[model samples]
Target: MKGPCTPCTTPAALTRIGCLCAMSCALACVCAPLRAQTSTFNGAVALSSQLVDRGLAITPATPILQAAASWTSASGWSAGVSGALQTRDPGHLSEGLAQVSRAWSLSSAWQMQADLLYYDYPGNERARLFDRTEAGIDWIYRDVLTVGLSATSMTHGADHQPRGAADVDFHWPLAGHFSLALGAGVAQYLVSPYDSYGYVHRPPPGVYGYGHAGLFWSHGAWRIELDRIATDPAVTRHGGNLVAQPWVGTVSWSF
Candidate 1:
């Protein structure tokens, strides 16, 4: 498959199962701090039926277990770290992330956030295993809707060209302790010059989309979510495309 993207570093093909799983949540965790009024820290745990990103499962069929911690300042800045482990027997570290972000109020109802994140793998050291760096920006509305765009380039790896992505999301309170959430996103893939384990059939420069709907519940410090997820073209690898519908259950607490 493909290698990672790091400038001046050798780039690989398009095998993202590992890199995407390890870094996406790690980087995304930094955004949690934007809501804190003063210095605050919190942690949570989660389980997912599949490790999904850009419309594909990075994991082989096993569930993914996740944990994260974040700290935020009243002054529009935050940082966080997270880790995920795939719970198959002899389970190994899936991914770890470290990220930081800052936000600026763009009026009483809109805000802009910028982020930088790094993806790390503990012991995997292939010439193609260079770590990844990601940067993104988000436009948030009334703290319930978000529009985001991002670009990432390999920091030290091979020749993976820069990638672009965008997404939109909305969450609304439906009743006491209940809420609804919807999201849609897409990613653009660069044409790979190297062989892609037979996945190169999608012409060159491919794009993928994903969508999801979820029900959320909050009681005391516990937060939970159940989501129905779908993707287009699914994937050609693994069990050959995805299931008709997949859902994930997650529970977390903030202390």
Candidate 2:
């Protein structure tokens, strides 16, 4: 479900700024109660030091503004959209995502969810090569631990073969709204041709691993988190820039 795709930088300072303002206003809505059998809507806005997805860094040493909103029905189905834009000069989009999922409870201590996710990289010519749909399922234990597995086919490319991935994550609560988060995952990719920025050099198709350890604290509608991410050294040695970032921090408000 992962591939080597370079982030794009477009000239649209005004556009990006407008998006930031709009999202900020939208997310300022009052927090609503989320009760069983009741539909709910939620929105959040955040500032992060880097844009990382699936343990891969999407932006190089740049801060970003992100916003997301989701709606969930009483039937355990949900849909959401999220976007991130660079915070510096000539700000442009980093990435956008759309997701739909369904959840079910199997027992008092266990639950499962199936998800379909789509990734979009606007203004990047190679976007078509990496943008694709990922289908996966996750199993959760007591809302603390999760195990996920997914696969996707690189349909835009000539080969049209499937890539598979799996990940494990743990979120343990400490005290007073503080928690420790840990995750590790590996992804498969097809070698991509070189580009002007040399973002990706032709390499063999294979699997690479990435992981993160972080701490989180929440109060009311606000949450803050800090994480240190690391990827297989081979990711860089193979001309993939997913290893350039070491630390990521974020402050978010959700309602």
Candidate 3:
């Protein structure tokens, strides 16, 4: 038998770590605002499907429900909580996640945010329970461009993995009533002692990256996005390949 696969320690991992460090320094240089001002409650439903590997596929034809509420004080400080229930196929796999976030305006053009996410995956051999924490800062320039850097660390039972990401987004107004947002990002996952897929067999540490660009059209209370996303080979081996295509559609409604 071939020697157990070695864990990944790729150049991409180093680059991601460097980006996270840079974001931290940038966030520290600005003074955070002291108050919050606005709040909102929102809900949405969506359906998704994807093909995994060459032979496995899942069609989440049923709708998934999600809801969230947020409050921002007068000083630009904010806090929010959200939850979702998603099901793809009966007797196969289902997941639910709850998350909370806090954000502060560091300046007129810079903001910092932190979040904790708890996820439950039921009836899946890959993962049953997971929890993660993420922190990041966003820089908004010219009222149209936003750049962000975030770091995420997840724990499943005793396994631990950390990931880092950098993203840039641009917003464009359409017809004065609609808006479009386009962005792309890259993510790198740090290897750990645990197997890549929950099995005892060790798998090589892989670099996973993705790019996304989307268009959102808003009309009254309804919003729709035509999105395209693509992931690297590392993610393909990590069970996210089912919907790995570069295209997907998402819709939302507000009341």
Candidate 4:
């Protein structure tokens, strides 16, 4: 079983651990009061038809079980953790995350959020190489539309460079409890010569785009969604077909 580096003996690892601890303590101090009062806690469990991330498929067509829990304070401070495990190999985690975020209302109709995230992949070597800290900012409009940007400095990969992504999404309400969801995004990376995605360009040439269109239905705490997911031909050719299914479906219940 793969696990996080322990003992913090190395200088680099120790620095990373120190930074993480400092951030955690800071956020805890800020949110402690609000958490004692008007904070809300939410959780969800879902079954997904496949696992996908940033235009790349992380799993074949095999289904995965996912769970997430979050706490949001009335003052817009939030923290969350989420994880998924592929049913085909349920003994190990496929993906995991810990995140902290702050949101502000830009106006009556616009809101912005800034967040820090950590990603972990336990069993897949290629995926694990990209595991790192990510920072993101997002602008949301009227709970229906959002534009988001994120970047990461990937020290675990051979490149040890930064990568970024931008995405836009729209959720349009229909007559009843159903909605239309559409989104698209692109990722840019400085491809290492030894990168698993297989590009060996000197100027760092790895760019891919992805998009999804789907319908969502919600009633009470239960939600059902089906999306037709697609990636650019380049992603399919390089990222491997095993992680590139055409359609993904999910059913989730939240509380």
Candidate 5:
């Protein structure tokens, strides 16, 4: 599930220095697993040149700083938080997210996951309610194919309708440590007004599809990916089926 929102800024700031400190802590946790059937923690930093969510371009086609930390239990329960900041002044938007998920192994090669995601924006909100909350599920087959469906609703002084989407993703291993990933999903607006939905500059009661293709490489705890992504019934202001950014690339480490 995907939705968008923005909120007022915090009195203090979390600069790059702060994020680095958090990442260091996360790495330490990764080495010292916790109890509860086995627990793991990991962190990563990413420089994303384009930020797109559910087919909407929340930021310009410039690099953005992102960081994340997550811990998972061997019993399939997990919790994590992540944050993103703009690279320059007048950035206007910054966000943090908290997530909780529980997964189950159905068989030797099948798994199911349920997730709840909350998004909070910090900075000037212009007195608009844009916070969003999403709950979704995913099914994975043989660790290579996945189907996901989810519903997203608003919170934190935002609209109270739900939007939903269903997506399937395929991952195929290539030579060496590289792999290919392809996916597409269609979304429906369950209950929303006709004009202007949170971050979706499009009319409500709309149904549209989104797609992505990417190449991935993995070595140890490090991963790198380059992708091209697009969505249909794109916001008219963007002038096409794709947002201002059609390309995105990322490099991250688990620890």
Candidate 6:
């Protein structure tokens, strides 16, 4: 009869609609965690000291304060803004910086990351505005070791010439949520007449080489870092300033 046929088709239609709804709900549940894991916010502060020696005179030690806020995504995307103030007795300079990075997972034991940074330096005597751009890559091996390489270019407001630099770093993890990093690099100032107190008139084709070592520890909500930096052939040419070096200690809380 026509009546029987109508009833039979209605039940089958209802069943199909219910199945589609269930499948949609299942997919949403599976994706919710991945979306939630991708975004994070963090803040930190640090203090550092630097010893500068010019071939002619050695100036008093310098202290620097740095603060930053960053956001990172679970899929390896990150962005951050930072500011720094450096003071030596009565003289000081301030800088603002921004950076972005992306990370790719290559395998269970290996990963790669790339980043770019921009900086603005104010109160510079030689150039009121200086622009610096950098690109770098990091490789992770065995969840304990990482190596990185980076290149940077710096431009002054007045000069057409741009400075170039290269950097390399190695990092290893230690016990108690601690890690150690070592770095070495070279930077060349292309313009000889550039006049920042940090890079005042001295030599054409100015070259500086540096080494850095640091330790980082994390416990509960607290993170701490201790770092040392040393440069050869002193960037400046004052007496008793044969070596230019800086040491840093930082502490931060994670939310």
lDDT of 1 by residue, 1-255 (tens): 111111110001101222222222222233344455568765656655554444444445566676666666777777767666667732566666676777777887877777676766453221124346677777777756777777767655466677877777666778889977677777764323123233344443356666667787777656666767666553333223232236655555544
lDDT of model 6, residue 121: 52
Tell me the tens digit of each residue's lDDT in model 6 across 1-255: 000000001111101110111111111121222354657665555444432111111123345554556666666666666555555533444555566766666776766666676655564332233456656565655434445555556654544454555555454769989977565656554323334343443443466665556686766556566656555544434212233335544454433
Q: Where does model 5 exceed 4 Å of error?
A: 1-37, 90-93, 124-130, 156-158, 189-205, 233-244
Off by over 4 Å in 1: 1-37, 89-91, 121-131, 155-157, 190-205, 234-245
In candidate 1, where is summed lDDT lowest over 10 consecutive residues?
Answer: 5-14
Best by lDDT: 4
What would the per-residue lDDT of candidate 4 be over residues 1-255, giving only the tens digit for each residue? 001111101111101111111111222222332335678666667777776665465556677777766677778777777777778888988777777777777787776777777778887554666577777777767656767777777756356566887777766889789977677777774233235545423323467677777787777767777777767775544444324577777777665
- Please list the residue runs of candidate 4 whose C-alpha ends up more than 4 Å from where it truly belongs after superposition: 1-37, 190-194, 197-205, 241-243
Candidate 3 — what's its lDDT? 0.39
**Which residue segments of model 3 deviate by more than 4 Å?**
1-63, 87-95, 122-130, 190-205, 233-243
lDDT per residue as tens, model 3, 16-111: 110111111112112222331234333333333321111111223343333333333444444434333344435443443343445555666655
User: Which structure is stronger by TM-score: 1 or 6?
Assistant: 1
lDDT of each: 0.52, 0.57, 0.39, 0.58, 0.54, 0.43
- Models 1 onward score TM values of 0.74, 0.80, 0.62, 0.80, 0.75, 0.63
Model 6 residue 169 distance off true place after TM-score fit, in angstroms: 2.4
Per-residue alpha-carbon lDDT of model 5 for 1-255, expressed as tens digits? 132211110100011111221322321332232224567666666566655555445455656677777777766667778776668733655667777767676777766667677776666242123356778777767656767777877665345678777777766889999988676677774333223234445453367766667786777766667767666644444323224367766565555
lDDT-superior candidate, 2 or 4: 4
